[model samples]
Target chain A: MSILVSNLSKLYGDAKAVNNISFEVHSGEILGFLGPNGAGKTTTMRIITCYLSPNAGSVKVEGRDIQTESFEVRKLVGYLPEQNPLYLDMNVLEYLEYAAQLQGVTKLMIPRRMKEMVDVCGLGEMKHKDIGQLSKGYRQRVGLAAAMIHDPRVLILDEPTSGLDPNQIVEIRSLIRNLGKQKTVVLSTHILPEVQATCNRVIIISRGKIVADGPIEDLQRNLHGGEKIILEVEVPGGQSFEMVSVQVRSIPAIETISLVEERDGVKKLSVETSNATDIRKDLFQLCVQKGWGLLELHREKTSLEEIFRQLTAH
Target chain B: MKFANIKYIFQKELRSFFNSPVAYIVIVVFLVILGWFFTSNLFIANISSMRTVFEMTPFLLLFFAPAVTMRLISEEKKSGTLELLITKPVREYEIITGKFLAAWALYFLTLMPTLVYYISISVIGKLDLGPVIGGYLGLMFVGAVFLAVSVFGSSITENQVVAFIVSFLIVFGLFMLDKVLFYLPSTLASTLEYISVDYHFSNIARGVIDSRDMIYYASSVGFSLFLGTVVLQKRRWS
Candidate 1:
């Protein structure tokens, strides 16, 4: 495991900010951390990066305990905090060099390393400008460059694209994707589509606990209870919609059937069934025996958004 | 504990100080106050010595030093950059020392122009060099103590005003403790006098190089810095 967080808990007075959470992240994969606001996502990332200490458990980065071998762990992990904290008085290049030197990048390597980071983060025109003069989007780019300047192996970004415009969000999203090819990336965000677009694995945290963790596809398959099939059948002019709905609901595994629409002498039906059951073949055979022409049969699984809402809702 | 890291932080802080207009303004205000006292006393006492300048400067430092050091850590905390600084591989003490040295260095620079007072007095008449040297060294020690207190104050909060006020109050309390001791029992009075910064500063300012006075200033700075580090550590845990 590139990172192992076991039984980690943090308390703020009487409140449990992070309660008994455990998970592992491996090498060369993008892990999407999905959580609502105040769900301990940032708290967990802070602990993994060695910025905050846990009240009760241990975090190991590449087999080094974060509490005991924190300097070594800090050397291996790069973190972009939630707010993207930066010095407004310093120019982009100056701040990046400061961060690089503090991270222990050799003096001789700093210029080349900074150039690479500036190029990768696309801070071309803004590198010489004071950070206070840059737009929020550009400042975020500067923050990213600072995090990656020393080229740590693991990157932990808490809401890396939180406040960017739509265009900037896409740019940063693709940038994160490219960076993930070589580094283990863990990013937390409320944007579910971005997770689908970028991450291979997903961990949904809710109220200080892990509700779901697995490959995205597996999560969408397993955590969600069922799939829905949209069926369109050509109807004889004399048949009523009630008869078709009754027929579709008569199948053994079919849980519910709703009439979607009627057009061009065809009736559309939505069929719900338990997960892991393939009813399309059964429905096709049923259509042939019923002497109805099946025009369309499409399967739609539960979306990640719906699954997230279901898992996180009170 | 890395020199390279400390150098980077120190250079960054110095650049930050000079980049803003506040440092220039504070330095000018400091000089104006000192120059006024020197000239006003020069005409009244007709003394060519800068003894009056050294005598009055420590009280001015109660306010000037805090003004220079108030934003050191408070700005970092307010701007969220403190988190970035701590997550780096450098030790916490490196940051505290780097910033302390930078503020002290700036305070020394403000003291630099006052050397003209010594030069001009020497040109007119024979000057007492021993008290002049001792006075300046005492001022340096006093500045170190004030800057350390300001850093500690800054570490405890993210508000610059709060830092300034807290540092001012602590330094004021230390400066006034000798006066407050007169009302106490005689035995307790001497111990409180020993603990007061002004008492030791006065002993040095009168052309003395006592190790006792030196140890007082050193230990005060050391203790203040240790507390500042503990504050940062507490923040990390909380």
Candidate 2:
């Protein structure tokens, strides 16, 4: 395992910030940490990065104990904290060189390492500019450059794309995806689409507890059960909404039918089934036998957002 | 244990000090005040000497040292950069010592200009070498103790003003303890007098380098730094 957290707990007075959380992150895996605000996602990331010690239990990076051998763990982990703090007084290149030095980069390697980071983080023109002068997107890029300057084995990012415009978010998301090819990345974001687009596996935390942990496909299938199918039908004559609802309820494997709309003798119905098995054929045959005109039929997979909401909802 | 990490942090802190107006302001203000005291006293006493300058430095340092050291750790805490530094491969003591050394180096730089006073005194007339050297060494001791206290204060709060105030109160308390000792019972007064920094500083300012005085200053630095390391570690615990 690249990272193993066993029975980790951190408490702030009576409230448990992270309660007996246990998980493992293997090498070369881009793991998404999903949670609501105050759900202990940042706390867990801090513990793994050795920024905060757990009140109980242990965390190991590359089989090194975080408490006893924190320096070794620190050498292996690169972290971009939640707000992406940087030395605003220093220029981008200066701050990266400082970070590189702390990471034990030899003096001769610093310029080469800095050049690589500037190119990768797209801090081309802004490398010589003071951090305080940069925009929020550019500052976050500087923060990422600092985190990746040492080129450690694992990267733990907390809300890396937060507070960014759409274009910036996509840019950073793809950058993270590219970096994941060589490093074990654990990033936390509530943006479900970002996780879906980038991470192959995810861990959803809720109220200091792990609600779900698995690959994308397994999580969708296990927690959400199945897919959502939408059908549009026009009766030969005007059919009331009640008729469609009653007819769709009788189909086996159909769990729920929500009426989306009904207008001009055309009705849109959203059908949910119990498993991964497709029930569109059964619905189509039923519509055909009933002499109902099937205008459109398509399957909408349950989105990660819906699964996240269902798992984290109180 | 890692010299490179310490050097990096030390250089960063030193650079940050000079990047803003704080370094120039503090150094200028310090020299101006010290210069005023030295020139005015020399004219009044009609004596060509830096003896009074050395004697006046520790009391002056009680105020000026906090100004230089107040922002050292508190600014990092306020800006959230402390989190980044501590998570690096550097040890907690390395960060604290790096900051301490930087603040001390700046204090030494500010004090270095006062050597002109010494040079002028030597140029103008016969200057006693013993007290001048003792005074410089004593000033360093005072600076180290005050820097340690200020760093401890900075570690406890994110507000630089609060850090200055708390450190001022601490160094001031230690400085005034010798005077306050007379008000206590004789037995307790004697012990408190030994613990007072001014007691030891005055002994050194008189051109005597007692091992006891050196021990006192060393212990103060060690104790304050030990507390500072604990304060940094306490953040992880809390």
For every candidate in turn, the CA RMSD to the true structure comes to 2.2, 2.1
The residue pairs in collision within model 1 are: none
Most accurate candidate by lDDT: 1
Off by over 4 Å in 2: A234-258, A262-266, A274-277, A285-295
Q: In model 2 chain A, which range of ten residues has the least summed lDDT? A: A218-227
**TM-score, cand. 1 vs. native:** 0.95
DockQ of each: 0.78, 0.80
iRMS per model, in Å, is 0.9, 0.7
The DockQ for candidate 1, computed on C-alphas, is 0.78
